[model samples]
Target chain A: MSTAFDAAEFRKALGAFATGVTIITTKAADGSLIGLTANSFNSVSLNPPLVLWSLAETAASLPVFRAAEHWAVHVLASDQEELSGRFARRGIDKFAGLDIETGVGGVPLLKGCTARFECKNAFQYEGGDHIIFVGQVLNFSRSESAPLVFHGGKYAHATRREAPDAKPRSAALSGSFNEGFLGYLLGRSHFQFFGQIRAQLADQSLSDDDFYLLSTLTLRPLISTSELDAGLAAVLRQPSASRLPALAERGLVAQLAMTAESDVAEYRLTEAGRDTALRLISAAKAVELEILERMGAEDGAILKSLLKRFLGVVDPDASVLWDDPTQVAGKIPGSGWDS
Target chain B: MSTAFDAAEFRKALGAFATGVTIITTKAADGSLIGLTANSFNSVSLNPPLVLWSLAETAASLPVFRAAEHWAVHVLASDQEELSGRFARRGIDKFAGLDIETGVGGVPLLKGCTARFECKNAFQYEGGDHIIFVGQVLNFSRSESAPLVFHGGKYAHATRREAPDAKPRSAALSGSFNEGFLGYLLGRSHFQFFGQIRAQLADQSLSDDDFYLLSTLTLRPLISTSELDAGLAAVLRQPSASRLPALAERGLVAQLAMTAESDVAEYRLTEAGRDTALRLISAAKAVELEILERMGAEDGAILKSLLKRFLGVVDPDASVLWDDPTQVAGKIPGSGWDS
Candidate 1:
């Protein structure tokens, strides 16, 4: 690292300008495909239908691109991140097993991109250590897939901004616990979502705790008392121990004999229990689908993504709820689970 | 619109490429300052510290930019969308009332951008209906502020893609009700969040329903039973009517005489009730702050944003919780709330 204005610093500064990830592809003179990932792509002019991108002079495919009469730029979708990484790497055949589409001038195009622009190489300009290639669009197509973004040298998810005019509904109670608070929003969203599902639970005379316990049973074939206690640690106000007996009496759950290795009691969902839990789960999922559909796919995906990440921080031990039964042997006597 | 290859369609294709908003500024030869917002900006070379952007050939400031010796590129921060729009418009002084910093060659620099690059005009190229100006970076600085992104002709939020290796912690229980379920995540996050606040509520011996009723009173000076019922409709399992009398018995609430305008009973939080609600709210907020901090500011903001949007879809009448007291007159008899 040099003391004065280093290259890494300059690269970081440039990265502050987020751009869509693009894979620029062309055919080599030897009849082989050529493509490389670049975030340097941008639109230059609309009337003449022009777009431009630059390539490092040191790139291995530079010679092929320089002589190519045309190339295709594929704007990757949010789901195409793996493809971006494949094209960005050095040595392996990038198009292996991929269904490639041949565009103008025999340039190979990748399917499922958010947008594709087939262009005729129109102008090349000197850009120290690189060559800026400007192309006139010959033909193009676009889809509604959410765009993948590159910022600060990392892949990102770009979500549509809320309309500016959609201000907080009211300032009537400026400082009150309104929709602006995260806790209130989460609580409200959770309760509202379950308010609909609770009706389904009522049909079976199951309490919220019973639903939680039954749902946990559905996650694995058999769950021990300790596992249930650990899994519902944050969810149930009381120990799951007290609730299991009632569920067992109701025939929704059945107790199993102690295993050879451990003396703890285990439980499994009976046929009736599995039927009940799945029925309730199916209903819950329907509510989830309706809310998600109303929010639209892109926003719904982002909301779930953020929730998963937030859960990573707030509930580091959340994995307990879905832990594999085979890994139960490794559970220390009282360390991980009891803590 | 044309029969083939229309400009509007081409523009839509180009919009699929997301880009960060940039405001390029420089002093005109005559000493007047000139600036315009452009997303047609990209880094051309790393070793030589080169960047480029383009302007429409028919623009009013093209001539100024073409001959300008120096210009600064300001990568707008997420909070600077207003400034981006200001510089994007035609006519009027865009620099008026701005706290400007003079950069290399006396170019005006705006404050609070994610990144700023001062460069010397090094080359010009013909780009169809636009003029491409390449610049050699002479000085630059960057901050950690999140960048503002423009995608599909709308402003968007760019959130970092989760680590590829951070898969769903377990597929151990495939297709079961587990952490991967959105409903489960929302419920867990909500309960985990409140689990911390319940202790504070327990100090005052308040049930969850009691807290809901008490918090409703905090939103306005006086809340009628109808308003409380409407506000807590989605939250409380039973009607608020059954819960308020208990709170009144606790001296946490005071019943007011029936108002002249309506016959419904109204209630206000007593000093003790207000104090208790605020205290519990403060504790919940501290929990929120801790979780947000643990999740990092960027992800936390994104989470809250998505939750707010999700709430909009699921709870259409959520505004009732924060409605203005004066709007009580508009309550159509047994129509909106009673629904």
Candidate 2:
């Protein structure tokens, strides 16, 4: 282990400490704006309001920050990853075309940060290869935006942890159903959410299988029986083969012209079917919006992100359903994924 | 905003920059262990392996810390939240029963931390009401455990973010089935996961509704028809009413005595039914393990945590299905949740 104590390992050890991404900005002696991405910023004191961040001694902006009387630290928000990337890069104009606010000593302040601190450069201390700059915060402002996290040498999402007492108690029966099971949570969330949209379906006289078939058909203007079956395999109990003909009989669906390339029949939603599908979809979207609002934006985003990652891990090949032409261009006739 | 530059506001702004929790430990002049919880630690340089953290001037151990020649910084893991709390409190024997390793200068080093840095206190700088101690690291180590994050004054879970290029492309047809939709993700994830266990159900000659009934029945030893219906309402198309009687005929379930309070008959899993349910559940759990393993432990945990939170927001009342007696003490007949 001692033999492996190299620079890469040292960096890896340091990466274990997660930190929020920040951009420290200052105005140079010649009035040029200088800024760089950093995750080393931390609050040092509360009474007199002091914060500290470090810059490499050989950094291009070292002299500018050294001579600066005042600077600002902008804590990037979750949505500001692109801005963080911009400032972290070298030799590019970081502030070009950006909406900025001038802070104390003419330091450039970026917009939409989760928090910003305008500070007087209090002291600079020497370190091995960096200059530690401590600043007395003169003024600051903050918003409720979620902070952008950096960990393990990559960007990450931070979700609030549940209080220990808030965790759901186990069920009475051992080896029975665990409400905390991933399967139960997924199933309950899906069914409960769909339950809210069931009334609209009932008003329209649409069955569960019917709604599944109709929604699957909307993915493309024309879908072959084979492709439709593949997509609806998980949600549908009855085959689309039997359901499509009934929808065609109702004039809600129509069969498309057969391409000589294959004998499989293609189907498309008729005008009535399209209208019915869209109305119910809008209602489903409304239910989604209501539930997401209850969960709040931060958690809602985290849930969706984690679900997407889970899907990627469990169903990597399911992308064909979304028809990303790159994967299934020739597989689907007249695919418009790229078009 | 300038007029509101109070301590609370300043603290709020600083909280916007998330940080990993750490416990800085040192040995007092009298050989007592001194440790405190902090999130102000940051790495300042690599060449000299320097790190820094601040101690409030008013802290009880300030005198010991100022005189200490060496200290250790332990970056807490996600499971170390309780330990962090313990060290944060005052007037307690913080290291009373802990297994500690003595580092340089007899500093107490903690176990199970994400990272540990043993450092020689090299410099002390004054910052308003705090003293910033810069340490040159003499030795350090790191583990792969996920670090505990602090954001907005609360502990948070940090999950790795997907690369921008890795996000799934939007569907070609806009208003159709978006694979990225939260509802679609929930539905697809649930269905696909359950799809794996369907083969076991089929082998057991059970339909989807029958399986749902069987699983719900396992939640309690004796579940009344009304309570069972409420539980299975979401996942089952046909009510447990017809399914339970059929299961009884198949010798998988049995009807219990009717109470004078109501004419409703309760049902319990027969020995055969219990065996069948357990077999299927174990199979489902196997599938879950496979999928979660593929997703990695870190992402799997984050996924489950987020899903649990999602369920809390969408279906707080669903706890009754799990038969948490505190929530539905008299609602279910013969509930043994607390047993």
Candidate 3:
């Protein structure tokens, strides 16, 4: 279903969209071979050069990435798209059959990466589907190689400067992430909204599931009876008993259709629902921006893609109940690839 | 003269290096627009949301950049390379005929740039021949179109993501400047060394003369004494009184005869010279990497090319020279195109 979440297709599409490529490798505590990849990594630092990248939380190499005492990121050569792809996919060993040498602490050094920076892990932030690992660079390497690029959603080798005598780029990618937000507008990707924000929102009383429900009603209002039945994801397990009428009495949601004529009826949001949705979207937008700010453009793009991809994978399709003749992949029944 | 610094030849050869295009404009205190070209833009912060770019200290608009309370940067698209070239050139009233809008703090924002962000000056570092200006993004704008890119020393347009369900590229060209460097090493092109690592090494202490030396060295070092002599900038005469013998006395360099019959000698770095040269190379290499790290591949390449072009204009062939090329364009007696 949905192409089985073909990692390659995802990467190629991701590359086609273009993201920055950073060689993220971790140094073993004993300083042995560092597993390096031109992962589109980013920074989340102020007091230090904290940076991050998303790894398949379930990758076998996660052990290496986790056990390492230090991690080094080498911005790949613009000509090294092949290298970035190699590291991105699931492989037995990333360092296999490549021309590499030893770096400080015997960390494997990519031969042609534009820049190599070794960092110490600051912290890891877990959200809906992916874990964001932050690292701070301590030592690094720099080269004359152009960075390998991930653009257009695939591994794309970057173009060279047209004229050596060109001018500087403008402030195209500039913005910040809202670390203090308590919610996010979850995308179709498995990424959940409000997990991080609410964690930081400082309200211990509100559960994530509750926040999730609040967010959903606020974002996609006027959910028809069937749409709600298909997309609700059992947020509160339907109360297993009949609480719909009880909640309806409370004015949380009101049925628009007098009767379910064709197995579907409209359930419109109340004024309170609209207000809550407005508040949630704003907070999530702020947090989305904060995430962008935390992750530089290139890395941020990767962050968005990776996190959002998970969303597209695990989340229910909005078209679940629609009579789709073309067969929308996401709208299919029970087709999500979530673990 | 060797084709190495044959200005025109070098321009064409290095032109083989590609980059993204950008038009940098600022609003003078008088509300007039001051514009220039640069490829040395980079992202520096995310928390406070910051971007950084470099300007040759000797540009005509240096004062405008230095004195302005705020400035706007327009990341040019591929079709805008002409704009990129025009702004980087000296003496031209860059904004005379251009259409632009004022944003955030009335900063001049050029039309057609894929993205734009306004910033309050955050930090400025004097790196070699340029001033690295760090700005905190106060406001920004985004467009739905693909960004114009500079690469292989030329302008490149983006191919939109393939249809159906792909998300449009939200990030513009910013961090992919080292393609030329990768090309140089990969033998895809030559004379791209500077396009790959120009202002990246600005933070390094290497002088423009040293950079010129490095550039020449990167292209098969100047092994001949005459070539070495020709490499030293003749335009800037050292005060006779300051012509001390420390260079010779330090024994850091030596002039060796090419052959017994010919008086032609080769200028070669001595052990100390080699150490110094390696040190400089390493430092500049770091700068190159930092450029990749901060700007990401596409933006980095564009920024490098833009800034390098500025360097070529301001200093001609001298690495440490920061004078706007326009000042001496007429005064320097080589190509009558000097004007």
Candidate 4:
């Protein structure tokens, strides 16, 4: 408990997580509506034409956001970090000095954006410390302009100029990758694909040794505990510790066999473990496809990992400012990223 | 024309495009090496384990990164923004006074990172302002730690706790998603899956409208432009723009003589256009799958749009930083992300 994670510390970790810029809105008093800037927005469906974005526990726009006939989500342009900053702040009368206007859902639509999505409230859900609002996008639009960038914790515009003269690595995943995951292979010529699995077991934390055990399970499942170390090392591509017995003792894994000579220890996904692994894999795959599409098919592998690093931010339900925008949107200055 | 996209303007715009965090290293003078921070890393393979990352043009660590035995990528942990910041700056010995170590490929390993990937140079192409270094990740390791984030050219971390309390909207793309493009949908999920796609298109840029038109043609061939607009509007949820007979007059689409009462125009992929569309869509689909695998299923949607924003980073070439860590290593300030 002494090494407790603090807000600033965790914020540093979480900000590494990526997110989409969205604005949450609802009708206000005096016959008009109010909205706030956010990067917690997400899409939920295509069949029903639905969308979703999250809010913090500290948002000032809550009442209005919850009180509208329709709230709209404007997917900020890559150059709209200022807009994201403006609306994310509290007590600023967001739309007062802006050139925003209302559209289909009568929600505030920011100016100079890449796309606008007008929606009616579809559903709301409680997630950990945040509120998840699902918007049924009633109308949407796109522009040729680029959206703003939100990396780490800063706001930036796009560098539309041409890149320098050298060609780097190919983005194709298999036979073209050199690192972690999303390396490449076959059948990717025309179709998009992704998948994985996730679960919260063992306190939602696993050690390097623990991860080795899991990867071993992925590569070769069901071996005796004694042989697990070697198997894990092989599959893990590094030297591994003798981790089987401890894991088994904890019931996170098992021996499950009898007879001394024939007795063996192997690694496999526990019911909970399997569930989590699958979920994680599925999520990773899903993002891989997205990066390829967005980059228009360049650097498929890089985008996948980049997206993976920002997972926390993308989850949206996990933020504090989700409720009160002002505090969350405070301009702490100093390059904004240097925690 | 003096303001026709100056370097600073492009740099500002490029800053708006968020990226992930990574460190690129090169063997230093006196048989040692230097490594610095970066957000331009990406994945490239799976079967043989390939990956890529970019280095910026003005980075101080270029000399060593260009001469390293093997470059390793340490996907920074969310709690490690300080580490990202330190490495991103110049004038200090990056590897001094830290508990840093090295593993495979003789590459320096940052402590407590989410994962470490060791790679052998696979491909190196020059594009625009960055040098793309593709590596074949010979070995890799992972730990259950969160990663640092980058946004708007700065580092950001999350403010999440293990338990749920008074947060606002749950940011999880958790409940269900409805409003999205198969284009947008596929764009996010595929790469995070960390799978590979074999593509056949050469590098080229297409307008958003053109990309949509081409995608439509790839999905449903021979549909007229009007039907395309209607279909696209349905997909986009945006009202179709008012396009008069001028398109037909310009032969972008042609009038059908089959209608006696009215001349219904038909839009078909031109022979050249068809070839181009087929090539581009094929390439786009391939990349989309790669991105999907990278985004993962849990935060799939946000990853979709997030990467969509990143793609707008202006690769300077059709190629992007797939996972090499060398393309943009020296180019921007603040290590090119939220450090």
* CA lDDT, candidate 1, residue A316: 54
Between the candidate structures 2 and 3, which one is better when assessed by TM-score? 2
Error of 2 at B99 (Å): 2.6
List the global CA lDDT of all models: 0.84, 0.84, 0.45, 0.46
Tens-digit per-residue lDDT, B177-252, candidate 4: 1112122123323322221221131124333345445445544334555565544432222222333243334344
Q: Compose the digit string of candidate 2's lDDT tens values, residues A193-275.
A: 88878888878777888998898877777888788778767777877888888889989999987778878888999999999
lDDT of 4 at A167: 36
- For model 1, residues B37-150, the per-residue Cα lDDT tens digits are 999999999878899999999999999998899999999999898998999998889999999999999999888999999999999999989999999999898998888999
Q: What TM-score applies to chain A of candidate 1?
A: 0.88
Name the regions of candidate 3 deviating beyond 4 angstroms: A1-29, A32-82, A85-98, A103-107, A112-147, A152-339, B1-19, B158-339
Second chain alone, TM-score for each candidate: 0.89, 0.92, 0.42, 0.44
Off by over 4 Å in 4: A1-4, A157-339, B1-339
DockQ for candidate 4: 0.03
List model 3 lDDT by residue over B57-93, tens digit each: 6677788888988887666654566777777677767
TM-scores of all models? 0.92, 0.94, 0.35, 0.29
In model 4, what lDDT does residue A286 have? 60
Best candidate (score: TM-score):
2
lDDT of candidate 1 at residue A254, scale 0 to 100: 93
The alpha-carbon lDDT assigned to residue B330 of candidate 2 equals 42
| TM-score of predicted chain A against the true chain A, for each candidate | 0.88, 0.93, 0.39, 0.45
